[model samples]
Target: MSDTRTPLSRARGLGSAKEGVHHWWMQRVTAIALIPLVVWFAISLVMLSGADYAVARAWIGSPLVMVLLTLTIVVGLYHGQLGLQVVWEDYTDGALRVFMIVFTKFIAVLFGLGAVLAIMRIGFGG
Candidate 1:
């Protein structure tokens, strides 16, 4: 195949980064994974509403509940990070875009770890 890109375009290295498909698939997968987890969480909250602190803590202390809650936190953060990454990539440019993407990811991870730690501490009666 003949080279179709103009000399200027080639010189500028403007082309597909070859990551679009992977990013798209990950977004879709995370969205699907979040659906059931979020529904379960919403229902659990509704059921727990107006309950005393001990009751709520006991609920979270269940092994199954702890595992599911951890999954929810991790998956939700990852999904959120993926979304903010796309927004940054689309709306920003150059150094600002890079900074926003990295910053968003870092914040997501930090918050995710903190949340998981809190959940574990409560679930384990620490």
Candidate 2:
């Protein structure tokens, strides 16, 4: 195909970063991964709703549940961060954009770690 963009348009340097498609693909993949995990988590919550603290702790401490919960935490935060980055990119510019991106990522990582730690503590009876 021939180049259809005007000289001025080309000179503006607005073009694809080539990384966008990868980001988009990852977002979709993570979202898909979360579907079953989310459903399981919700149902588990309902099932455990009226249970005693010891019962809930035992349930969470199971190896399988701990692993699944960790997976859910990691994937959910990653997906959330990706979506937030897109929103920040779309709404901000320049220094503000950079700050927002970094801030969002930092917060995501912080929260992810906190969640994992909490899960581990519960699972390990710590």
Candidate 3:
């Protein structure tokens, strides 16, 4: 306890373990951003139900809808990965933890791409 470590050393706490606050804050920030978007999404989906393919296409075809949808998907996916990263850190066993984190990141990127591509197709292919 009397080692007299530098302030940087004490603040780091994790030493070389890694800085986790950014990941934590990004997760929360994205979540906060998504709450309002998701409410709008829910309403849009409900009202768009029973719409034919063309109608559905037109609904998502507008530039405003397209951009918002893309943003929502991207943020949601990133946040999802961050939240899962924390969960994996807390629950995963030793050797497999790194593997799980990488895999989760890959999956998140894939999902985000899928959502963006889907929206783009709907917006432009019509």
| Model 2 regions more than 4 Å off | 1-20, 48-53
Off by over 4 Å in 1: 1-20
Best of the two (2, 3) by TM-score: 3
Query: Across residues 8-90, which tens digit of lDDT does each residue of candidate 2 receive?
Result: 76776554573436788899999999999999999998999999988988888899999998899899999999999999999
The ten-residue window of minimal lDDT in model 2 covers: 12-21
> For each candidate, what is the lDDT?
0.89, 0.90, 0.85
Give the lDDT ranking, best first. 2, 1, 3
Q: Clash number for model 2?
A: 0
Model 3 Cα displacement at 111 (Å)? 1.5
